[model samples]
Target chain A: MALIGILGGMGPLATVDFMEQIIRLTGAARDQEHLPMLVANLPHTPDRSAAIIDGGADPLPALLEGIDLLNRNGVGVIAVPCNSAHHWYAQMRAHSAAPLLHIGEVCAAAIAPQVTRAAVLATRGALSAGFYQAALVARGIEPVLPDREPQECVSACIAAVKADRPGAAATHLSDVLDALSAQRIDAAVLGCTELPIAARELARPAFALVDSTLELARETVRYALARGWNRPV
Target chain B: MALIGILGGMGPLATVDFMEQIIRLTGAARDQEHLPMLVANLPHTPDRSAAIIDGGADPLPALLEGIDLLNRNGVGVIAVPCNSAHHWYAQMRAHSAAPLLHIGEVCAAAIAPQVTRAAVLATRGALSAGFYQAALVARGIEPVLPDREPQECVSACIAAVKADRPGAAATHLSDVLDALSAQRIDAAVLGCTELPIAARELARPAFALVDSTLELARETVRYALARGWNRPV
Candidate 1:
């Protein structure tokens, strides 16, 4: 099996969520049957939004450092769980020698066929940065956004997740979803990892919701299995 | 604060262990004080030992793939918890744009002042590959090893860890430590992450031990704080 390396900790809960998904998707009968992994959860990273908006610390150096560590350790493939961090994917790809599985790309590919015009409910930074819009556009899907007031609510929802307040985030996100529904958006893409937990709680099946995290996990499972890492016991 | 990216899962437990240490060391209060991270825990890596001993699949490609992911994400520094994987550090470093933190180097640096001659009790692959010896020598420290019989015991201890048999691994490691004591080595380096858990259980105070996992954690905290990622509340 190939050694999987994770560069994580956009939010601690998101990292845990991703790990749980990996384990559940592996379908291991026993603990030993699970594949080996190398993870560097550096939670000390500066805020992604702060880096983008406030012109503070750039996170690219630290992110590259993590890649070096994985490369040095001989990890087979790498994935990052942070949705907003994908904004720098092009630069990171240019500097890296290893193959990186694109979570945003994977998520876009999965949801493209299912939804025609999906509302992207993410952080103001993510929306402003055009991270998801570009990827969705490439897939020929039109991405929608919440109205001005709900956009603030969506930002608050993202902040609530950063504060580890999933319940509060869900409430805020519920409002945003309602606003998106008012706009007649067909589906909502939970563009942030923390947003999914709240989206799951709201349980509004009135409109299809695309969870980037779950999609990333599904793609990761397929990637691992296709490479024979999920050998049968 | 700089972003710290982790490329991990040489073993899942080891990755968890490292993350726990980072949290403990950070002394974080609010969630914001914690580091922001991006993780991709890939467990599809081929066995490091098989690659070294039996000439199995090379992990370099996979390792690079992981590095690229982190680099693209903009991590400032990267760390991996596996000692055996460090054998490929030089090659990985050459391909990496970010600075990779060296667990072995961190361990060697931490133990250098305390001991002149240290006995290494590690996996057969680690011992056979001469990674520890080479690292210690580079740091101007002399590394001692157990005889073939005791070395076999150490290998058994490592196997017990991979099998998740902490008790058996502890017992075997105790025997190896006893053998090392007879040779009058200054201290024993629990060069493997799993071995530290076992060594702590055995708890032979008479033999000073260098735990690479614990040391790496300490270094990570220091690195984070030094870089201003974590601030006192």
Candidate 2:
């Protein structure tokens, strides 16, 4: 079996959250039965939102460095858990040794069987780039994107999660979901990884939630288990 | 600030749990404010207890391989969140480029300020090695060691956490804690990294609970914040 690589830490906490989902979703019965992952948690990568929203420094060099380390270690599958980082998916794959798993494609696939229209909750960069929106459209689903005001709320909710303020994050995130529910959207695509922390308490919401992180994890697991990295020999 | 290295994934969940603590403790106000961590989440590490208890395969080679990878990456501080892995602390440090933060020593420091006697809860490998016990003793604190029965409960709790069964893990861990409290112990040292997950809901407990994972994370935060990794430059 090949090594699994996670080029993560867009925000340190979100990366760990993604890892937890991978562990839970793997359903391993023991320690060794779980996947072998090498995580390049490079939090110093220039902020993806800042880079895209403003004319800030490119995160490409740092992202490539992480990929190089994973590639050097002979990672069979390389996965980037951050949704916003997918803006550079093409460029990242161009310099990679292994195939990169697309979060937007995975989330679109998860949302298709359940919902007709989905709300996109992500960073302004990811929203403007339309990576998730394009993927959803490609799957024959209507993308219910937030307007300017709601996009500001989405940004705040993401920042709150990064600051470890769960209360304010959840409150603001719930408001965004409620507003989208009023639009007759059947699902909300949490296109930003940090947003999932805030939406964690949404038990039976007004609409279904397609967590990009979870879907990406599910895809990673499916890709891995099929390759027989599920357990030791 | 130097890049932080975490050689983790003894049980993948335990490593993620520790990373969450670090992020929360860092008090970062933004994504870039968090620490830059490179985690080698190698879940395929040979069972530490099996090696020490039943003479199974030596985990040192794999342990050294992880350390070498971190060394090559130019990390300033290396931390191993697993208590059982500390059995090879000296040897690992001998091969490591960066100084390894000793989890037992950090836990002993956390326990020394408040308690006279501390209960030791860890894996069979860590228990038999007496790393945490010796650290407490060196700090002029008496170690309230669990008897055979409670140790069995501790083992079961660790196994349950690895198996992703919270109910069984929590119940067995509570039993271990209750037995320690009956012995008039001042505090219980969660000498195992996985034990903290089981004890998460023990609010206002019967005795003081010194979590080894949190203490190690706290020490890591202090070490990091001093070097000005608390926020972006």
Candidate 3:
């Protein structure tokens, strides 16, 4: 069974959420039945969005350092849990020996066949970079975005979640989801990793949430299974 | 800052819970402000309880593999979240270069000064091995064990949570807590990692629940900070 390395700590909580989802999706009855994972939660990496949008320092070197650690530690493939970090997906892949899993690409591929129209709720960095927009267009799904008012709500909710105020964030995010529902969108993609925590807290009955984190988790399971790392349930 | 290596996947969700707590405890506003972690979630390790109490296969080789992975990966310290896994803490420390954080010691030290009498809710393996009892005695605190009937309930609840039926487990665990409350115990230690999740879902108002997982998380933060990994919030 090949090991899956997670180049994480874009925000530490998201990495924990992604790893939990992978374990839940794996359906393991025992410890050995679960996927073997090497998580490098290097929260010390420079902010991806700050570097991308602002004239901040490049995060590529720090990211490369994490990737190098994973590669040296015998990980076969790497998955980055943060959406904003995906802006550097090309560069990360360019420098790494192991294949990198793009959360947006995985979410797009998983949702493409299911829905014709979708809305994305993510960090300002991801939204500005059109990370999911590009993937959605390539998959033939029309991307719907929130208006300015709701976009502000989205950013605030993301910030609230990052600061560990998930309950408040969930209420505000549910309002954003309601606004999108009013637009009659078929589904919503929680493009940011933290959004899933809020979505789960909202406890809405499966209102067509296309969670990028869960999609990445499923892709992780698929990747491990393809490598023959499957355990009998 | 030294990387904190987690020897995880004794039951994968516990590892996730522990990692998430570490992130929340660190209280970092950005990625770089958080502690770097190297988690080797090797779920293939044999059942700790089964091996300890029921003469199941030795999980030492698997544990050693995980410990060795951390030692080789430049991890300064190691933390194993599962309470039952601590039965082998001595052997694990003996074989590994990185120092091990005894979850029991951390829990005991945290609770000892606050309360004189406390009851423990843990796996049968931990109870049989006298894991927490030894630590509590060392800390000059009285260790209370549930009688056979309540102990069976504890085991059942632990199994239910491991099987992912946290709701049922919560209900059953609440009954165990009530039983302890009837005995007038000052506090109860959620000696098992899964118990804290169940207890939180119960939403009881500050009934003096001492969570070992949360204590371990705090200890993890302290360990990093003592090594000069402190980040300004």
Q: What are the lDDT figures for the candidates, one per model?
A: 0.73, 0.87, 0.84
Model 1, residue B127: C-alpha shift (Å)? 29
Candidate 1: DockQ?
0.14
Q: For each candidate in turn, give its C-alpha RMSD to the true structure in angstroms.
A: 9.9, 1.5, 2.9
Candidate 3 error regions (>4 Å):
A112-114, A171-175, A178-184, A203-207, A230-233, B112-114, B181-184, B203-207, B230-233
Per-residue alpha-carbon lDDT of candidate 2 for residues B152-172, written as tens digits (9 for 90 to 100): 999999999999999999999
Name the docking class for model 3.
medium
Q: Which pairs clash in model 3? A: A31-B43, A32-B43, A32-B44, A43-B31, A43-B32, A44-B32
Best by TM-score: 2
| Cα lDDT tens digits for candidate 3, A1-233 | 56889998877888998998888887765567788889998877877777777867888888888899889888888999999888888989998898999999999888847688888888777888897999998888889999998888887777777778888888889889878877867788899888888888876633588888899999988898778675523
> How do the candidates rank by DockQ, highest first?
2, 3, 1
Which residue pairs come into collision in candidate 2?
Answer: none
At residue A114, give the lDDT of candidate 2.
63
Please identify model 2 stretches exceeding 4 Å from their true place. B230-233
lDDT per residue as tens, model 3, B78-194: 999889988888899998887899998899888747677789889888988897998887877788999988898888887776667788888889789878877756778899988
